[model samples]
Target: MNTGKVTLLSAGPGDLDLLTIRAAKALAAADVVLLDDLANPGIVSLAPRARVIRVGKRGGCKSTPQAFIQRLMQRYASKGLHVVRVKGGDALLFGRAGEELAALRRAAIPVEIVNGISSGFAAAASLGVSLTHREHCQGVTFITAHLQDHGEPDWAALAATGTTLAIYMGMSRIESICAGLMTTLPASTAAAVVQWAGTADERRLVTTLGRLADEANAAGLGSPAVILVGNAIGEAEAFTVRGFGRAASEGLAHAA
Candidate 1:
């Protein structure tokens, strides 16, 4: 018998090869694939028999609204179609999967989750950096600059324990975050932004807290990116990462 359900699937960061075998199977069996911009299209192509729906919500671009996306999932599932909502990274993180889960539940549709690799891990791997460096950061926090006019986040808290902070979708708010961190993190504190992370055209800006914002802006590092702030970022400046700020920490060590 056909099932009416929506699977909130994670397509991983960018590399299609990172997809899990089960996720690959789901994609193959999906009757409709609702994919976000961050989720690679090549991965979805595996589900050639399914309807491909590009619901990429790029910042400042024409996007299918969140409500609309949820409604589509529910509507499609009601028709006994297997809907696979492909999200980049993990669906439970900043992907706003809760809302869709609620919508599906209210409609009494079956739902499942297929986890995927996250951008934080992918970006860190591409740069050979660790979010939990034993000598520096002990924990990691994943957040997003998800506001239009929201004030700066609490730098004192973010800087207090030296935990790694991985930000997604914060290109526009980079200035505010950097400025806040500079107050306590020092100008030399390692900081970086990875653009097109885990992809062939990936780029990394290796700079200190003070220059992180300027370098990112100057480089035009826009959406579909990740920002990491912490001493662990020192690894990103390594030549192997093809970084831009080779000497970004020259004077900050003395300041710290």
Candidate 2:
């Protein structure tokens, strides 16, 4: 019997237009598609003839177990059915692609990865700021607020690096994260949060490291938002029309 193949695809920050050609092709040819909560529902239309299954994993909500998702992929591939595992943002970045890849390999299954735009980039674009500016930051760091082992990340060391930080799954722990970074980074370091990035409903707030948590809470920002911190962010008044003190309703417009 011929073994089916598996494709790990990135859905790209909740926007259908952000999907890559390769990702779209894979979706169109999939025999079965397993989609995450972050993926846009419109993507399902790409694989009209395939079995589309919702296997989303969201924080503080009922999520599909990782083990079960892996097993389902393995089973489907063994049955000679092409499986597409769709995740939001880049599949390899905080999407748990490692576990699924390892499991498929152990099961002797064929698997391929198709990359897509990450939320960090989208967030940066929405704020009209570059994560890496030669005068400000030399590099960028992508970190998750949710720890797999439930242990705290070394925020002080990360802050010392002086790289721009793009924090994911951080809304719930915003206060602590801001406090931790304050230990090493200055209280005046620029910070911003982009919620629902790359879409029509996107919202953004710019503030200092010391006020990020408070401003985010005041704006009612929650999970599924990307938190950016670094001097590279500068000030909101410089880019957004709403000036520095208030949250902007739309984040993509550039200031002339």
Candidate 3:
């Protein structure tokens, strides 16, 4: 019997056009496709004849068990079928690709990874700001608010790093995260939340670290949003403010 292979493909922030050529090829050739809830539904169309399985795992919602997903992949690949595991954003970043990789390896299956643009980058792009602006931040850090142990993250250490922070799955704990960061980062530190980044329903809120939770709540931003914190955010916020001011001034001038 011929051995099968598995490809972990990143769907690239819910936009099919953002998919890499290699990722598209893998999907087109797949015999089985394991889809995630956050992934763009259009990706499934690429796997015309493949058996598409929805194994969505969303926070605070009923989700497919990780073990079951791993077993399904292993079972399909062992039967000489090309399996494509479609994940939103970059598959390796907080997507549990490590667990699936381990399972496939233990089953003696061939596995390949296709990288895609992470939501962190997408969120930043949507705001027209660079997370690593030379005068603002030297680097960027991507961390998840949700940990497997449900324990707290080292907010103090993270704040002390002075790197731009792109926090995922943090909407539910925005208040706690903000409070924790305040211990190290200044209350005036700039922050922003970009919800549904890269999609048509995108929304954003810009405010100070001290007011991020309240501002986000007032704006009704929730999960599937990226929380950005650091001086880098100031650049975008400033631009937005200037644009708003200019528009208001033009309206008054026209009225006069």
lDDT, candidates in the order shown: 0.81, 0.87, 0.86
lDDT per residue (tens digit) for residues 51-153 in model 2: 9999989887999999999999998999999999999999999989999999999999999999999999998877777899878989999999899897778
- Which stretches of candidate 3 lie above 4 Å from their native place? 241-256
What TM-score would each prediction reach against the true structure? 0.89, 0.93, 0.93
Candidate 1 lDDT over 25-136, as tens digits, reads 9999999999898888898678988998889888778989999999899888988999999999888887789888988888889999999889889888866778898888
Clashes of 3: 0
Ranking by lDDT: 2, 3, 1
Q: Pick by lDDT: which candidate is best?
A: 2
What TM-score, to 2 decimals, does candidate 2 have? 0.93
Clashing pairs in 2: none
